[model samples]
Target chain A: MSSRLLSRAPQDTPGTWKSYLGLGVILLVSAFPVYWMFVIATSSDEAVMSSPPALIPGDQLMVNLREVFTMQDVFFTASLINSLIVSLAVTASTLFFCSLAGFAFAKLRFKGHNVLMFIVILTLTVPNQLGVVALFIVMGELGWNGTLLAVIAPGLVTAFGVFYMRQFIGHAIPDELVEAARIDGALTMRIYWTVVVPAIRPALAVLGLLTFVATWNDFQWPLITLNGTDYPTSMVALSDLASGNYVVYRRVLAGAFVATVPLVVLLLVGGRQLVRGIMEGALK
Target chain B: MALTDVRHARTEEPRHAPPKRQRFWLHRFDTKTFPYLMIAPFFLLFAVFGLFPLIFNAVVSLRHWHLIDKEKNGWVGLDNFTKLASDTDFWDALVNTFGIFVLSTVPQLLLALMIANLLNRKLRGATFWRIGILLPYVTPVAASSLVFAVFFSRDNGLANWFLSLVGFGQEQPLDWRAGTWSSWIAIAVMVNWKWIGYNALLYLSAMQAIPKDVYEAAAVDGAGPWRQLWQITVPMIQPVVLFTVILSTIGGLQLFTEPMLFDENPAQANGGYDHQWRTIAQLIYRVGWSDLNLGYAAAMSWALFLIILVVAGINALVTRRLGGGK
Candidate 1:
């Protein structure tokens, strides 16, 4: 047994070496673009456009930031405020509505309950892009053409959110507890507020994180609806900055980095829950 | 206990007035009402935003009208549909959309599966590795696509630098935003880079759920890792593979942001040079926003919607067959 154990150690070392080498390769490939973004962000326009590119950080980050801020009213402050307000409003509304619907679907018995659930699930198959043109007209008609409401209104009740919450509530809350509250003559809203809310706290946290990240990172609809006239999301502003003819590489990179930071931080904080939520939502 | 008591009283004391009275009060009272009330906001919001807009879109698609002249939106029975059927530009956009979808999605899923398999092995700092893989997916689309646009630029681009090293340098940096195939390749790379990790993570999660004993038994039977993977892992995760494939197809058909951003140059508004990269979504945007042909844009949207539904349906059927399940 001792001889076998000694032999295994020699064999295992090469395998371990290979595994570490593979891991190193993956880490480099995955991180290089992000590293490159920062490197460019700090470099001057000339350094960025230089022949071999600046592999290291340069001294123009602050200057580039100043340019980005002064170049447009859309970038540094207004867009940031717009993004924050839209994301916060959307997240809060989604949480309130989705949890309520989720609770009903999970625990409540009502007329057309099964049918309603099926319809909700069916909507998942319809891509929101399909309704873009008509929705644009609707927005125009409603006088929400350049407002943040145009961006936030359509995304308020995500079908995925409802589905996710229902699954979470089904497993996390018990019917017996709710029934007990009901027997004591608690109002329907009272039981939900006092009992069900406490039980599903973790699910709410997960949903909130997911919803916030999604709203924060959303691009296409905002691109269409908010056209950078009155207020634009961070993404739309960044797109305009990059797409313009007077290409200042450092400022563009700076904008990109700023846009990416919030999402990276959020993902780091909620990575595990996010992964578990996605897996549960997809597989189940 | 209370529910059971209420049920017992209702059944046993139907003829007795006192028990009936108590049971009636119990039956009418409960907290279920609250759950329903709490849940109403989602339905209310969905009715206004989700369902109404969808129904309204379908209605608008059938009418002949411009946004500026709403009074002219008279009911035109299937005229929009018929016009789309005969429009060559519509067909071209449809072809371009599917072309790019196939070019990107096929290789993306294949590469993702391979990467997920590699990552599934026992490795050091597995959490770090997993997060690194997902970095691209999490990067904001606008920002990453901008980076890609710069990378694919004609002059002094990194892609050309590497290509020249590999002996493909004789041609001018391939005019990525210009020709049909070049623009498609650029779009495909952006789509693949952004999504491959997402699909990989999904595949990895499914793979982890697979039992270890099956792989152990295969190894005991003198099977190599590749053979075990092919025989055991692939079959076990076939359902997930189908799911991603269908999801990717739906996503691919929509193909808006990359093409829109990549073709942002005013000169290339008709897609790249000769309208090579113009997709259905771009066409819809161009008609509605740029040209102010809202009626034509609505028509195009309906046409694209039908195409998406059909493609998704076909994808579902094919995957189900390949998955070998009822």
Candidate 2:
């Protein structure tokens, strides 16, 4: 394993300037739209219509943000707060429930474990959106049609999260550690709380970050459930701003730019882990 | 603090052990029933919110249901499905969905493969490069789609300006959302912009897992860089390539958000004035919510689910053949 790790040293993969140049161009294309967003967010309304359009940041960011916040049609600030509450609630519950279930699947052998696990893996391929029509109806029947509960409840524990946690726990927390805990008379819940949680902290972090970003960026369900209401999430609110007969590009981009800052910061801080988690989730 | 408290309490567990009968019961509960309890939430939620809805969609599609008039909902027995069969709008949306899927996914994967190869080498500021490419992926779809909508706007948009700079489309700037092919290309650009880097990173990780010795041996056998890439890198990453193809197939077929926001009137959920780029998802949304016909929407939803499954299966089959034949 150590030799394998050593083989990944930079000396082995000698890169050329052509590759660097290609990457540079790709990065520029990746970043320009975001930069353009910033430029329009900070510029005047005229900048959106100017010849060649604004490519540099202007001083009207405060002005555009103020316009967006105080606009009577959309609840921009409330949407941000709503997104935070939903994302955090979903992340917390997903972690606790999935980890507990993952531990049960991994270490604590029980009846029907393989069958139940197969079901979980199978559900991963079936998009939940396939049933959105009935789901919306179900929400209405349960009197949760317009509430945040409709969004938060179904997402509290995802099949993907359960499968991911199970994979991580099975690999990271060895059977011997679990055996040792059981031998010490640790109860199942006790063992999960003590031995399992700490061992899967990295997995928890990865899952947490991915879930938060995904929830924050989620659009379709939230749009259907919360559009035109005062309780819209940030993404729905941004869509609201984008639509309409006459969209103020400055205000629209300003709201979008503000909503995206937190996710960008998350990407900057936990990017390596986030990338690893995504790749691992796909490959495994 | 909680962990340490648990540990401290654990060390003194034998001093005040429970009675044998109580311990036996506790042990039984812990070993036999606890795992079921741990896993019960997932099954319960899935039954209520996942499986039930999926199965119920068939029932809903078979009936005549409206969004607001609950009293008038009645059994119609596949009428909605038959209506959908002759619906040109639905067919157009299906065609648009597949059109945008092909246009976006083909280029996105190809560029992602090239970018991954570039990134799989030693480079300065590697973290910057990785994170930089992922900028669009992290941006909210609503936000990025709106930004792209403006960038592709007809008169004063950057896309037109660039076209002029390249000595084309100077007289009449292209109205991106007005034409069928133009709107698909515009939405495809939005889809490709967000996903290319993400797919690149996935490919890069897979590339890193290929042992260095394989490349060294290939190099020693007089395989140039291009030959090594085709014979060694491409063949080795075939599974990952197939995996991404299926992934994109599912995602591309269910195209939403980008085109939904790209619409001139998003509240109406119309893809364009001519229904140019209406996707199956948007069509479902329009029929269900805007038109308030839940039964037809449910039918469309099931059809979409089947379509995705079929397309994904075909992609998997074709990819396996291509990989193995080579």
Candidate 3:
């Protein structure tokens, strides 16, 4: 490892300008649409509708935002809060449930453990959206239609989260540690709470961040469950604004831009962890 | 403060379970009941939400379920499937779904591969580059698609504006959402934009995990960058490639939000007015929600599920053959 580090150090030589230019162009294209979104959000209707549309940002961001908030009976603030609530609740429940289940699978083995674990892994292969037909009908039957719970309940703990946590717990914590905890008269649940949770916190963090981002961006199920209702969610509500018969393009863009700021901040904070979690979930 | 108090209390022996009968319950919990309880939520939830829906959907597909008399269930075995066979909308949606999938996934993966290679180097600002590539992945599909819808608007959208700047589509600003192929292209662009960075970073991380010694040894053997990339990088990343292929395959038929939101009608989930780009998912939503034909929608759902399974199964077979080793 030390020699590997030394050799990797020599690779720290200044990168050629070609590499920079290549990456620069890629990043620009990758990020330009988002920038264009900002440009539209802050521009006037005449400006947005101008021939050879404006590339530069304009100063009507607050004005358009005001228009967006004022147009709909659905307040933009309620949508934001609803989105945060759903994402955070799903994240919290998924982390706790998946980690607990993963620890049980990894450390505290019981009867039918392998079979249950196999089922968990197998379910990962099945497409999740296939259940939507029944889920929506059942949601209506249960009077959960247009409610966030209809969306949240099914997604509270995912198979992928369980698989991810199991992998992390299996590798991170040694059997001796679990055995030591048990011998210390720590009950099984107690050992998991004290030992497994802290030991697998990094994986927990990764799973939590990924789940939050995924739930935040999940459009279809929420779109279905919350469809044709005035119930609040950022994405569904945004689509409502977008598809309105006589939507103000610039104003709707402003609402979209406003809704994206939190996610942009999340990307800044959780970006690297998100990448690692995905790779580790796949390869590790 | 309250959490710490609870933790402190948990460390002490439980005075609540003082009776011998209660002690047995605690022992059972610590031994046999604990693990099952730990994982029960998943199984319980899956049985209710996952397995039950799948099974119920199969049954729902067989019945004549309509909204007019929602509670009335008339047995119509294989009738729904027969309708699906002749359903032009189903076929059109099927073609569009695969078309969008191929257009989006192929280019997305190829570009992602190239971008991953560029990002694989031990370069400065690696974090920044990773974040840049990842920015789109984090953006909500609704917001991004809404932005793209605006960008691809009939006349005044920015896409046409830029294209016209290059003297293309100058005489007439292309109405993106009206045409069949053009609408497919527009939706494909949005899908690719959202996923390319995500796939690239994943591929990048997987590439970084490739042993450094392999590249060094190949370099010493006079293998140039391109040669080494083909000879080593591609072969080594085969599993990850396979993984991405499977993921993309599964994600393909589930394509809903981007096209659903990118449509000209804005809120139209059933593709567009003529159903030009109506994907299988949108078709299912249309049948169940708009037409209020639960049986037909359920039938379509199962059919879509079958398509996914068959396509994924075939791909997995080819991938396994090419992958030689796990």
Candidate 4:
């Protein structure tokens, strides 16, 4: 037992130098495109068209960023703000609604909990592409097409979020504690506010971060609903820059880099939680 | 026991202050209705956006609901499906979808498995390595596709320059967007680049949960690391592998954004001049929005959903059998 304990240290593990080399290569391959994007973003227009392409960054990043903002056709700043609003709104509501439902499903013994949870699990398999046509029509009927409402409404609550929270709440919080709160005469809403919310904060942050990124990066639906609108999401605006007739690689990449930086930074901050969230969902 | 009694009495004072009758009513309401209210929003929103659209699609698919045609919104039962049966464009899209699915998913899963195996080993700066690989996954699809488009462009592309440096296809750099196989490869790179690290991390975490003594025992025996990975880690993480397989199948079949933006004119919804890599989702978007044939698009949507269900089922079945056989 003593030997086993001693052997469990990081220095005693069996990783070879070969593994480090392989991971180094993986890291390089993984990071190259984003690095290339920055390189292009900072390069002159002539450098973009150079025979080998620009392998190094220049001093033109500010110029290109300025160009992306002042470009005539795309509303870059407005779309960035639009993306922020839609992402935050969706993330907030998804966290609240999913957690509320998840708490009830986990702790509160209701008549139809099992059946409702089964429905939620089943809904996970239905691809979003299945109902795009009909959804477009429905949005049009509600006069929400070409508006952020059309983009935001369908994503207010997700089946996966509810399931994720339910699983987390079931496992993370003890039934005895909940029963103790009940015995102390704490009402359900009050208990959830004070007890459940605080305990499940890590899960909430993970879900919120993921939802924000997914909503921010959403391209297809927004393209379908808000393509021609003056106020588009950042993704839609990037697409506008990309698909233009006069293809300027520098401008397009600068816009893409700008759109991607916030997400990359968010991931850098909350990557461990994100990893925990994904693995927890898949393992059990 | 006296200490517990005193603490309980002190805590119970607040509840006793609310008269017994009111407390009883409050508890009943909390138990009965609060659960329903908590779960109501999900059901309500899903009905409006999710289930209703599905049923609505079934209804719309049977009618002639072209926005431009003079015979607008006519009930033409089964005609749209029959016409779709002979639609060459839909078949081409289907082939391209499966082609890219195979091309991307197979390599992505294998590479992810290998990377996860590498990451499973104890290493220095572990979080840095993890976040490094996962960086691509967070980049927006629109942005990544645009970046890759430049990378794989025929003229002045780093891909071609690298290929030239390696002395393969030295004379003629591949026009990645022009050729069918070339376009599929380019788009597959975009898809695989985004997903490989994410899937790797999932596999890595599952690997971490496995008992370390298992590997130690294998090493004590005659097993090499390669044999141990195949015989142990792969089998141990079979369920996670299955989960990822099903997920990739669904996401792969419904591939959009990458192929859509791969086209120079994304709004055109033409995957290419000859429709080289147009997925079913792109085709649906084109038919419904571009052509204004809501009925036909609805029919295609239903067909694509069924295809996804079938493909995912097959993938799950095959994954299970592979694990069992091994």
Chain B TM, every candidate: 0.86, 0.93, 0.89, 0.94
Superior candidate under TM-score, 2 versus 3: 2
Please report, in order, the local distance difference test score of every candidate based on alpha carbons: 0.76, 0.88, 0.83, 0.89
Error at B224, model 2, angstroms: 2.1
Residues B1-326 of candidate 1: C-alpha lDDT, one tens digit per residue: 57556453333423434565775675565433444566566677667666676778777777776756667778897888888889888888888998999999999998888777777776656666677777776777777777777777777666777787788855665667777888899999889888887788788888888876556555545655566566677778888988898899888987877887675453224676577888888888887777766667877877777787788788878877765667
Order the numbered candidates by TM-score, best leading. Answer: 4, 2, 3, 1
Give TM-score, chain B, model 4: 0.94
Per-residue lDDT over B1-326 for candidate 2, one digit per residue giving the tens place of the 0 to 100 score: 57556443444458678998999999999999999999999989988999999999999999999978778799989899999999999999999999999999999999998888888878888888888888888899889999998898998999989999999898888898888999999999999999999999888888777877786656545665566666777777788888899889988988889889888668889899989999999999999989899999999999999999898999888987876745
Query: Tens-digit lDDT track for model 1 on A1-284?
Result: 43332222111313356656765786676666677778888988777777666779998888887887777655556787888898899888888788778888888888778898898888788777777777887788899988999998887878888888888888888889878876665656677789878988878777887788778878867877887585888888877776655676677778888888877887688766666666565566
Measured with C-alpha atoms, the lDDT of residue B259 in candidate 4 is 94
In model 4, residue pairs whose N, Cα or C atoms come closer than 3 Å (at least 3 residues apart or on different chains), thus clashing, are: none
Summarize candidate 4's per-residue lDDT along A64-119 as a digit string, tens digits. 99999998879999999999999999999999999999999999998989999999
Model 4 DockQ (Cα-based)? 0.59
Tens-digit lDDT string for candidate 4 (B1-326): 67556443463367346788987898999999889999999999999999999999999999998877845688999999999999999999999999999999999999999998888866888888887887888888888889898899888899999999989777887889999999999999999999999999889878888787776666545565667678778888898999999999999999999999889888789999999899999999999989999999999999988889899999999998987745
Candidate 3 chain A, poorest ten consecutive residues by summed lDDT: A4-13
lDDT of 3 by residue, B131-211 (tens): 888888888888888889888888888888878878898888798988989999998999899998889877876777777
User: Which portions of model 1 show Cα errors greater than 4 Å?
Assistant: A1-20, A73-75, B1-33, B69-73, B216-221, B264-269
Individual DockQ of the candidates? 0.38, 0.55, 0.51, 0.59
> In model 2, which residue pairs have backbone atoms overlapping below 3 Å?
none
Task: Report how far residue A131 has shifted in candidate 1, in Å.
Answer: 0.6
TM-scores of all models?
0.88, 0.95, 0.92, 0.95
